[model samples]
Target: MRMMVAGLAMMPADAQDIEPDGPDIVVTAGKPLRVDAKLLRAAQRRFAEDRPAHAPRATLRFELWRGYSRISATDVGLALTDGAGGQLPVTIDGDGRVVFATLPAGRWFLTAPAQSQGMHLRPIVLSSGTSVEDRRLGDLRAQCRVMVAMAKADASLLAMPLIGMFDAIGGCASKRFGFYHPVEHPLASATATGAGVMRTLRLSVTSTSYEAPLSDRNLPNDARVRLAYR
Candidate 1:
């Protein structure tokens, strides 16, 4: 949205020295949101008492969706990994939401299954004394290739290790790519594509083209690559 980085300060420059670039990148701001303060305080207490062994405590509410409709994702198994060798299991509630009460106050990688598709959520940050309540992460319907492409284009999207591994493994037998407008920023899609030498990948909304390489060091030189999207 406004591209607000947590706990970061803004730089100041003289207005006379500034000049316009070719075109300004526009970022749309989302609705203002806040978390439950009481819950956050309790979590901070738990984190302080637990010390090095335990992660901070906080609650997560994942609103599951299918296209534009809200759907129940109860019992869906979610894998949580915090890069620092921490792992946990998170399950959705009967109301299609995930209520995770305790987690570290840092970015995390979330992998889950939605219907017949795989969902990946990365850089899910949980502040030490805050809960993720009103804001929504990226959509679960997005395909791995689309997500991977976004990660490739944006370093912030690379928070998911598995997605990085997918890019590294190379020989892609098949791939599914789909783009969705992030809930937090409805004005734009997660990524934009461009043309290159290899295969062609199109993003419907952006109409941007990008090359899809077929060869990988780990795979045979003649290995075929396939891509799909829903």
Candidate 2:
């Protein structure tokens, strides 16, 4: 059971909470309102977090894909948890989504407690496809829902994409392949504002290789090449 270990990751840069596309306001209600730094920080943290105690809870739905296509994941388990490592009840719904069907609106992550060499915990990693491909078509990085999959009973869990290439030029100029790092990373993450509302986070796990440069040269688009030689 050979598995490709991942390399150092460029944790998909997350989207900072920002005022929706508008500009114009000056210094507020005419007097510098001195806010307690701690309180201010707590307020800002709300955007990325909520409490199950926040009442009525909200819904978080996930649509994980195979790179940039409509094809979806199948036959896998979703391991969800909170910042403290308590398991959050997550499931795959009828719509083929990994969901916290009803959870307190707050920051949620997909990871579990792993005592790997004094390592506190790492996100549960899942690999889709014969070799997951829908995840690497672009530089689009998202982290509202931390990602890692449990696809095989005995599989090597990697922390990041094992290979990366310039999606446009379709070449190995990036030199992202054939590297390994010990760090494990999440697949996706989100702060569900589950105030009886549903938030959807979409992700794609991609693994790609250009066959033209290989010995066969005529492999199918879905060819499963050895990651060691990609």
Clashing residue pair totals per candidate (backbone < 3 A)? 5, 29
Write one digit per residue (lDDT tens) for candidate 2, span 1-230. Answer: 11221111222223222111111111123332111122212222331342222211223233433212222223434454445655555466564555433454454444322211111111111223322222211111111112111111112344223322122322222222211112112233221122243222222132222111111223222232222312
After superposition on all CA atoms, what RMSD does each candidate show versus the true structure? 19.9, 20.2
The digit string of per-residue lDDT tens for model 1 on 100-194 reads 55655665654444341322222222323323222111111111222233333333553455445543543122232122122221121122122
Query: Candidate 1, clashing residue pairs?
Result: 175-228, 176-228, 194-209, 194-210, 195-209
TM-score of 2: 0.22
lDDT of 2: 0.25
TM-score of each model, paired residue for residue: 0.26, 0.22
lDDT of 1 at 169: 46
